[model samples]
Target: MSGEDFEDALKYTLQRKGWKLSTTKKTGDFGADLIGHDPKGRKVVIQAKRWNSKVGVDGVNQVIAAKAYYRADHAMLVTNQYLTNAAFELAKRTGVEVWSRKRLNAEIEANIPSKSNK
Candidate 1:
């Protein structure tokens, strides 16, 4: 998927997960593609990347900066690719959540209601 399409999917997924999401402008987003709050009202900033290679520290840093800029309580980097070891370490130290492709897919699956329970 394209970067824009990935971002849109993330926004919809977040909404399904009970977040009030808002997409940022195409340019000058300062690393944030979407910003919003959780059900508990804790602010969140998200940076979405659709890359084939491993995502690096630069992406993590951008999300961290965006969190600070938006005064968000939580920051997340959502990518369709895996994160580098260095990027993961940086995110752990900075309290930023890095959602790799696997993790994101799991989250999406978990949010889906089972028809058996319906």
Candidate 2:
């Protein structure tokens, strides 16, 4: 998926999971694609990356900066691909959640609405 498409998909997914979501401006986003409050009202800042290659530390740094800038309680970096080792290390140190394809899929599966509920 393209970057824009990934952003949209993430927005929809978060909304389905009961987040009040909003997208940042395209030109001057400063690394944040989506910002919102989760179901329990914790603030969240997210950076969405859809790339063929592994993501780098730069993206992790951006999300960390954005979390501070937005005064969010949680920060997440969601990517269609996996992160580089450097990025993973940085995220671990910074308490930023990194959601690669596997994690994302697991989250979706866990949160899927039951047939009876739907």
Q: Which predicted model would earn the best TM-score?
A: 1
lDDT of 2 by residue, 15-52 (tens): 98889999999878877999989999999999999898
Reference-based lDDT, each prediction = 0.92, 0.91
TM-score of each: 0.91, 0.90
Scored against the true structure, residue 32 in model 1 reaches a CA lDDT of 94
Task: State the displacement of the C-alpha of residue 101, model 1, in Å, after optimal TM-score superposition.
Answer: 1.2
- Clashing pairs in model 2? none
Q: Where is model 1 more than 4 Å wrong at Cα?
A: 112-118
State the TM-score for model 2: 0.90
lDDT of 1 by residue, 1-118 (tens): 7889999888888898789999999999988999999889999999999998999999999999999999999999999889999999999999998899899999878877789989
